[model samples]
Target: MYAIVEMAGQQFKVAKDQKVYVHRLQTEEGKKVTFDNVLLLDDGKNITVGAPAIDGAAVEAKVVKHLRGDKVIVFKKKRRKGYKKKNGHRQSLTEIVIESIVAKGAKKAAPAKAEKPKAAPKAKAEAKPAVEKEAPAKKAPAKAKVKADDLKKIEGIGPKIAETLVAGGIATFADLAKAKPEKLSEIIADVRGNHVTDTWPEQAKLAAEGKWDELKKWQDELDGGKA
Candidate 1:
């Protein structure tokens, strides 16, 4: 019998005693781990598929060792800009051997229940004489709309980063100027690439003050907004 299971953010077709390498897991070497995300299962003559994942289905495995994969070279260059960069990376991996596949009857962890707040006691009302009803007051005038600034104008901020900043409530130059570098990084944590935000607040401050010439000069001296 063979089963398709998801482990360490990747899927694999595994069977009894099969060794597989996957992304590094938190579990230590020689420890056992259970993967509950079985996507498919086949037992010789019958095939079972899940809508997403079948309930009570699991794959048990034992961690064999932790190691790194082959080195990969990354190269970047600009044809006429006289820029070239080369780097090498090795992916951390873990080796595991599948022990068994449980098609059903696997116990799932139960979630903790929250205690509900107790209801307050009702207040008693005193008897009072009814007076003539007054007319409702007129509504106040609506406030003027505040337009969102173009955050992309800030150095090193692309369209995706701008959208992410806007969603995080930093929609204006003033807002960006007030944000800390660490907080800004947390806001755009999902954005791709290595982003340097150390100079972002200063650039935003200059933009907020309408110092276009100075901002332009500073941007010209910067390499992708790195100070």
Candidate 2:
């Protein structure tokens, strides 16, 4: 039997005793890990597919080791601009050997349930005589609500980060411009990646001032919000 399972953000077709290398997992070496995201499974003569992932289907694997992949060279250059940059990177990876494929009845790790709070005691109602009151002669006009700006316009600010920033009350370009890089980092701490917000505030300032041309020029020279 073979199964297509998603592990560490990547999918692979695995079978019993098969070794596979995937993105780095938080699991320690020599420990066993269960991947419940089985996309497809085949048992000799029958094939089963999932809408997104099959429920109760899991692929068990044992971590072999943790290591880094081969080095990758990244080269960047601009014609007639005298701009050239070269970098190298190695991706962290983990090796694991598939142990078994469970078609059903796989037990998932459930979170601990929190105890519910007790209900408040009900208060007794008291009857009181109603009094007639005079209404105000005039009411003040409502203030206009400020529209949220598309923060994705700023380089390095993706949909997830933009949503997170909006949730943190930094919705408009003016608001982003006024925010500090350290605070922005704190707001997006849950987001994956080594995001650099050094140029975000300046980019937001330019956008807030309606300097699209300048902002675009600066963004073109930036690499994910870093100078």
Candidate 3:
């Protein structure tokens, strides 16, 4: 019977008494090692495949020896530039012999605990008297919706920063006009690159008051949305 198992980050198809060279393991020579990552097992008559690895299966082996592999040379060259480089490396390896493949073991997997059945969903609470709920509903959203300003029309505000301002509850021109420059910067703290908010509140004040010609004259004299 043979089993495919993973060891030291590599996989090998191994059988009892079979010796395999694999990446160096920390175990000393002559110490026993067990691999529980058995991906496939074929016991002469039956074949068992693991979803990823068999739960109770393992491959037992003995560490025979540790050694380094033959040196491999690596060379590099650049034409015309006359650059040349060379290197060599040897891999650490271990020799191990498979001693046994245990399909099931004394250390068997624990049976999974059964999940408790879900409690039936609670029934909805009975509705209150219509007059009681209706009174509160009328007063719930008392704050009227304010018309939002085109904040991008402000010199220092771009599309992304405009959305950020709106999300921060500064949706209208009047809101922007009253906002402090430092506070505006805090609102759009995540906007890309540094922004000079020095003149934004001033510009917003003009836009909120419907003085477009004056706002435009000031914007034309500004640079990169900065005062």
| TM values, all candidates | 0.51, 0.51, 0.48
Instruction: Report the lDDT tens digits of candidate 3 across residue range 1-227.
Output: 99999887678999999999976677899999999999988989878888778888999999999876675565679999988754444555689999999988323367899999976544523444555778876775668778888899987577999999999999988888788865776676567644556677889899988999999999887754554
| 1 against 3, candidate with superior TM-score | 1
Model 3: colliding residue pairs: none
List the global CA lDDT of all models: 0.80, 0.82, 0.80
Instruction: State in Å the error of residue 163, model 3.
Output: 38
Clashes of 1: 0
Clashing pairs in 1: none
Off by over 4 Å in 3: 105-227
For residue 183, model 3's alpha carbon misses the true position, in angstroms, by 52
lDDT computed for candidate 3: 0.80
List where candidate 2 sits over 4 angstroms from the true fold. 105-227
Off by over 4 Å in 1: 105-227
- Candidate 2, residues 1-227, lDDT tens digits: the string is 99999887668999999999986676889999999899998999888887678779999999999876775565779999999875444555689999999998333445689999876544321222121122233446789988999999998788999999999999999999998876786677667754667688999999999999999999888765667
Clashes of each: 0, 0, 0
